[model samples]
Target: SRSLLKLLEAKALIELSNQTKPPQGWPSSPARNLEIPPNLNPDQANVLQLFQNQREQKEWLLWGVTGSGKTEIYLRCCIPELEAGRSVLMLTPEIGLIPQLLERCQRRFGNAVVPYHSALSEGERLATWRYCRSGSPCVVVGTRSAIFLPLPKLGLIVLDEEHDSSYKQEAPMPCYHTRDVARLRQQQEGCGILLGSATPCLETWLACQKPNNSIGLLHLPQRIAARPLPPVRVVDMRQELADGNRQLLSRPLLERLSGLAKRKQQAVVLVPRRGYSTFLSCRSCGQAVTCPHCDVSLTVHRNSDGHSWLRCHWCDHRDEIATNCGQCGSTAFKPFGAGTQKVLEQLELELEGIRLLRFDRDSTRGRDGHKQLLERFAAGEADVLVGTQMLAKGMDLPKVTLAAVLAADGLLHRPDLRAAEQSLQLLLQLAGRAGRGEQPGEVLVQTYDPDHRVIQHLIAGSYAEFLEEEAAVRRIARLAPYSRACLLRFAGPQASLTASAAATLLNHVANQLREADWLAIGPAPAPRARVAGLSRWQLLLQGPPASPIPLPSEQILRRLLPKGVHLAIDPDPMEL
Candidate 1:
């Protein structure tokens, strides 16, 4: 408060005004000002040149490879607007990015950074909001929700990891895309929107080419150190198992990982999901135990003392393990697939005397916990780290000489158009984790389809070519920036009511925007149709180039939903 008041004092906006009020004034002067180091690459500087807000309303898309320093590029553009005394709103798709981003912004910009994410305490959020509204907070770094932070002088908006699904709000009003929101806000406030990604979402790349809809294109094709993209070898598990090599880790990867661990170099293990076991299925009847409260499977995890416990993945409910299957009463229940926890157990057996750490939603549940765990890992207290998608986002480990994806096809089968793009992004990011400080990193992807085109493209390090192919597929499918796409989801206790309302809304939407030649799909049951005791129905809408669907997503949802029903709109949904 004192620092803010001092900045205001320097600007002559506020006088001492008696030097004392009952309780509403300065505490002390700014103590020990913080300095922001200039840590941006030369190519990122070139990007700042094109997007200085004096140029045309061109929303430039930057594609930076992993370990190529993309976050540094974002800060480069944000610095100028901040210096100009106008607020900067930098939106990130990942919730975990809040802390690292906020610390960097605060240290660099000093107390000017007001972070707003779900992680903040209620008091912190409210205080931060008040500060932003007063026009004193120069930088507002946050997750997708920060889009609504009151900032009239907001001059620059950046969407980092533009391809990530976290940008699309799953519930509540304004279920809008941060990228789209940033673009609209840029127009509303005359700011520059910089979209940065290692593997640019296919839709954004396609939008860059379309002169009518896009601003311009900026590409950073190489990593800062010009390090060769890691060598990616896709192991065919089918072949391995066929040759009687189904011992969990493939022979090639196991040998490589062993050698790396022996040298005391760090290793990161990427699994498809968290938990020890997602479900206990009876091999005979093929029925898996499920949560009675929600329509999702429960995960099996060991307690701190190492006893079995059945825990719901959706709800936090827990139950004692069942000796027999719930339906068949068969004693043949077994964990069919492996998660990070299960893999960690197996790794412990093979690689003894190696310190291992696990990072996932379960482990990093609180602020101090997250910070302490990261500090320990960064300080080399652990050798092998196993994690879920959280491993791919932040937490760069310089000594990580090897990164192994326990299962590469984990995200490949999702019913989303951007699944391939996301897979490539994860592979690129995970591969980038290795060889950051010159020790030469290695990435091993174990998949059945070793010759898949996505694997081939990822291994070749040709995301541009992959983008072209994915864009063509999208064009044929009539989705995304080629044609605008939005997903409408409805959930309520009464299944029929929710389905009926969503169907009615989509029908109304189709008639209102439907043309003689336009194309759209959905008004159907969503993938993972039920969550947390709610039967969910979805609508997928599209419009042609001549007819753009007016997206009053918030208004439309409010109007159509039953009073008790919940509605959400995901513009440019990563998951369909």
Candidate 2:
């Protein structure tokens, strides 16, 4: 080995080396794929066998719809790895659900079960990360970034909710989809990979299409009761508002909520944002007072300074509430949008003596915040929970028989093209939260655009129809799940400088990028456009090649940059 190394080193192609092999009898095993539980579905058995028998590729998209018993199927795939004494990392959308997943992992693996999440202290996270690497047939339950967890014998990787946008990492190091990263790692290490979701991202589905099919597609569509999907009722908000329904709860929804309460069934009111008011807008000028630091609108929050602050959402820039509107210097300013706090106040007045719980970044800021709130809600201590998009992921509650999307319209209003897909996913996921137990569940979706295709499809429970319509738009617009996207953002104090830098950077990118092969948009200023006093500008790139090209983002940083500009390359960005 030393001689071989010396020969290779002489060729001047060496950086560093830490070659090692698995422990004795570590990975040798005859195919046990057919050993699936006798009662397991044939499709489930096929999925397991694909992992056990197919070694040519490392990734598998287990496209199981809600209540498809995908979790059980995932368990089947994990059996072989566990038997071989290898570790598994299961990634979920949020840590709020981590405890629930941990319960399942523990129930199956007992003391062998291990968990990791951002909510854990740094030391605890580090310890668990180290422990997984130290060798154990452990299962690590965590959020998207948990893909980086180092395990000595990684035999299987499972990404629950593969289509969920939370898989797109926004901060910290090695910012990449836990799903994609897991696939890469599995390939590198020759382990099996699984991507599970109720609404599989088109990218994953398309990737698995036969070569003649790019990859393979698998499905588990029916509920485990195999009971039917819950009934979804769409309430048009336009007419409801014209009748003077202030907080926008439709009459039918109010009646349903009353019935649920009387039946002792709890419900959820979903408000997609936190805080009282996102911004103070001028009634006269239609302009909002924004934060100078971030390239976005300022949030009006009551702070300890004895006054309200216009706080940047991305950074810590703050300005006291304005006496005059910046646009027209109009004194007639008003809170234009509703957040969780506003929704909470309205729901309290609208409903009877219901015990309400609120969940959001602000509410879950501390270490144990997520755990405590989730526990209380799960224990049925809260009759109603009001929250931001934080509550829109995979959370199971048997008693939550009714879910009122106080406003589903917010999902449609986004700079992202996956807005419709995201909107549908959130609607379905939130709706799934209801009727888990014996009592059936119902969803009340209040949307002004009731006729929108996505809303219509969700209301009718026609996922296939929705996919076809959505795929049409994506193919036309070159949006995702069909192609890959890279976002480059430049941020700094001066808007002009940031814009100039961003434009110049975009020019360089346009020159370097293969024009005929890729799509490029902007060097335009970002939507939020500023944060914590830094002006932000962005460039969005879309590619459809068989292989992804590493974006030239860092190279731009290496080049001469405008003084205060910053750069972020978000592949498959969730937000603009």
Candidate 3:
């Protein structure tokens, strides 16, 4: 309360009598407070020129390569708006990125840069929101929730890492995407929208291809230092099995890690999951232990003392390891697949005397855990950093001379249409983490499907070829990029009620489907049929590109849903 009041007092925002109007005049141009102009390549210069030339609200995709200086372009482009005495809003995908981004923004714009995100205390959030609303030229760097901030004089909006799924909000009313919301705000407020990503989402790429004139695509194909993209070595797990080397780390990765450790160079190990094991099964009954509240099997987690426990990732439920199998009353149990914890354990055993730091949902559960772990890894306190999906995006560790993906197969074979694209993006991003500094870096991807197209693309480091091949498949399947997609999920405590509610909604949607180009699929059980004791079902909607697909509004849907049942509608969903 004291902090909030003090801030309010400083701005004279607490007393109506002392409230003064904003400054008498808004500067027509920036004071050129940036000590020096950012150096830009020809391609970056062209993109910056386009952004500066936009007099009206427009949307553009800055599709740059992994180290192609996209952030530099963003910083340069945003300056003009700030100079014109208008606020700029920049959005990143995760809280883990806010610290680094905030640091850079602060260095560039000083106190004018306001950091807004859930990580801040309520007073800080309110102060930032009020500052942005003070009609002063400033920059607001934040996560998805920052979209709703009231920056009335906003002139430029940026969505970094646009391909990331974190931009999509899954709960509460108006579950809108950051990119979409930014575009909407641009339309309403007459601001320029810039979407930057190394591996652009298929939808955004396709949107850029549409001859909208106002929407442009800027390509930055080369890294800033002209460093050659790291060479990705695809290790076939099948070959390892045939060679009688059944280890999680491939021979090549093991050798590379050994060399890295010997040289005191840092390494990053990318795992697909977080717990010690994906699932555990009873050796006697061949039955997998499942979460009591969720349909998914319980993951095996081990504490520092090495005591094992079962945890439900969906509901945060914990259970002790049973001495006997529930089904057959047998003592033996077996773990199914490896996760980050398992890989960390294996690395310690295989590469002795290596200092390893683990970064994942479990390990980084504390408030400042992400920042602390990353700082330690960056400071050379740990030789190896083991993580899951969190390590794939927006993390630039220059000291990371070696990067390895334990298993790419975990990302593939998913029931989602964009699995292939996601897998490719993830591999390429992980590969890009290496070779960013003086020492040449390399990536080793271990996968069972060495012949897979995604693996082939990674090995070649040809994003164009991968996109063309993936686009062709998407076109043939009439899935995203070629079409617009939406997901409607229904969940309830009772299975019968959930099914009934889903069926009713499906029938209603079908009856209301007047457009011939629109299609709806499924009222079937979702990928995970039950979560937190709630039975779930899903419906998919697809329509022609750029066409609007109408459905019940939040108010109407809330009324239609059965008691205890809830509905979640995601337009252009990242997952099926």
Best by TM-score: 3
lDDT of 3 by residue, 1-576 (tens): 878878898997775354333221112345346446567888888877876676553788888888788888878877778888899899999888877777677667765777787867676677776777778888888899989889879888999999898898877645678888888898798888889988888777766766766568888888877878888888888999999998887888878777675676888899999899999998878999999999999999987799999999989999998889989899999998998899989988998887889999888776667888899999988988999988878888888887899878879878778888888888888887887887888888888988888888888888777887888988898777678877888989988899899888877778665554678888889999999989999988888877777786778777878789999888877788
RMSD of each: 6.4, 9.1, 5.0
Candidate 1 lDDT score relative to the true structure: 0.75
lDDT (Cα, 0-100) at 49 in candidate 1: 72
Residue-level lDDT for 60 in candidate 1: 73
Q: List the residue pairs that clash in candidate 3.
A: none
Q: Per-residue alpha-carbon lDDT of model 2 for 444-491, expressed as tens digits?
A: 888889888777888888776677777788788756656777777777
Higher-ranked by TM-score: 2 or 3 = 3
Q: Which whole-number lDDT from 0 to 100 does residue 42 have in model 2? A: 65
What would the TM-scores of all predictions be? 0.87, 0.85, 0.91
Per residue, candidate 1 scores C-alpha lDDT tens digits across 1-576 of 989999999999998553212111112344256665565567767766766643676577767777777777776677677777888888877766666776676666655666677777776677777778888647788888889888978887888878787787655655666777777787788877778778777767777777585657776766666776678878889999999987778888767767665686888889987888868788879998888777778888864467877788776778887888878778887876777778878877887666788888888887656666777887888887888887887556788888888777767766667678888888777787887776778888889877777789878988889989887887797666567666777788877888898877766656555553444576677776777778888877766643555555467558867788888766555567
Residue 78 lDDT in model 2?
71
